[model samples]
Target: MQFLPQAPTDRHTTLEDLQGIVTGVTMVALSVQFLQAAELITGQIAGLSLVASYPTGLSFGLVFFLLNLPFYVFAILQIGWRFTLRTFLAVALLSALVELMPRAFSLSGVHPGAAAVLAGISAGVGLLVLFRHGATLGGVGILALWLQDRTTLRAGQVQLGFDLVVFTLALFLLPLATVLWSLLGAVILNVIILTNHRRDRYIASS
Candidate 1:
């Protein structure tokens, strides 16, 4: 019987990494638009930022960027400086993009259900792109990827577990129906990563 390669044969070029990071962050920024339009939240630091932003009158970008600051130490210690740097860059870009997108293109009249699904799809694919390029958006993503590398846990599963906690806390802050719709988006995002991001199935290194 034949089997797929279990190891990465080559590293991504510098230019490839650049484009990948840009594309990934852009898609994620787009996802943020959908979430904001519906006032729905997803998982991870991004969701926490939204929750905080709503009541505090803070920009999601500013809150997200600040929330990620402390995680850089954890990311550097756990994943190495190169990965940490890339993650920082990705996070910074996403923060800026989320702010800029709203100014350039506005979204309205989007149903929460459709927004949830669209956010899930875009964010999932975006995160996959970032992961393949050896980067993340920081915070929970950093921990999730580290656990996936060190233990038997899948990154998506670890993230989903974290998501549940975030959602639980969110219940106290957000409307019940809003939280439920947001949960659907989170589930879809994690399911995509759970199914497609196994080391055994995809071995390409950035």
Candidate 2:
């Protein structure tokens, strides 16, 4: 199977990569701030970061970046060089954004409940944009989506299963009520994709 680079390339390859990198970093930085305030864990790689943030004093961006490194090999082997490069750019962007955004913008108090909903919406919108453009936030999510395409299992189920495990861990670490609320946010995120992320309508119109 062939995978196209999610973002368009320019005459200068460096420029194209730089664009992806910048996008990745910005999205992740905003994402982390939301996550931190909301106490909600996102799907896939971000979820892992949510768990890791507890034991490790490292920032979410650092943990998120390191955790995703192993998956780059999978992206390379399964997807191809173009995809790997795009994923690399995305990963780098997210790492940089998460680390730098807070310094640039001062974010104050947030209501965790509201933050969870807002974070879910923000993440879902950001991810949908990336996916529509032929890019992705690097994680096992890309692999999981591919697997679901090839197999009988649904992509939503795969993601939900992973999320459930992460939330369960969260429940143990935090409070059960928080876990439940976070799941609500996850549900909101998935709903946005399921309804609006389809290409068939756009393709037909075009």
Candidate 3:
């Protein structure tokens, strides 16, 4: 059987990557704000950080950064140094933004449902940007991307599976209603990724 040629992939310029990463991380930081305002947690490392922060009085930024530390080795082994470095920078920027955004402006009276949907959309698009730019926010993101590259699994599906475990653990710590609402946000986020983040359609590289 004859095979068709693959689509051409374009490389992003340094400036393009810089702007894209910044925009992606900023959007994610905004989603964090929404999650916090509603006292709801999504899934993955961010959700784990929120779960850890709520009762411990620890800063989400600190917890997030710390949790991602061990993943660097796995990322380097599974992906590459370039991707790992970009992931590190993205994580650091997000952590700082999560800390600083609140000082600039605070969210108030945000309904849980609104927060869930908004956070899902914001984070979903933000992560898509990061993925296209050859970077991730680290932690589960790195694993998801690696799995998608190495196997037939979609990154979003991998993340959703991990989310199930996170939510299960969350049930022990958070209210049942809160976990369900947060699951809605996670489902939305993953669905966006599953639907849009196709390597076949988006043949760009950074």
Global lDDT of each candidate: 0.94, 0.67, 0.94
Ranking by TM-score: 1, 3, 2
TM-score of 3: 0.96
Best by TM-score: 1
Candidate 2: residue 199 lDDT (0-100): 40
lDDT of 3 by residue, 1-206 (tens): 97654675579998999899999999999999999999999899999999999999999999999999999999998788999999999999999999999899999999999999999999999999999998999999999999998899999999999999999999999899899989999999999999999888786689
Question: What are the RMSD figures for all models against the true structure?
Answer: 1.1, 6.0, 2.6
**Candidate 1: stretches off by over 4 Å:** 1-3
> In terms of lDDT, which candidate is stronger, 1 or 2?
1
Residue pairs with clashing backbones, model 2: 6-134, 6-135, 24-93, 24-94, 25-93, 25-94, 25-97, 29-98
Tens digits of per-residue lDDT, candidate 1, 1-206, equal 99857667878999999999999999899999999999999899999999998899999999999999999999877779999999999999999999889789899999999999999999999999999999999998999889999899999999999999999999998899999999999999999988988888787688
lDDT of 3 at 28: 96
As a whole number from 0 to 100, the lDDT of residue 11 in candidate 1 is 83
Worst 10-residue lDDT window, candidate 3: 2-11
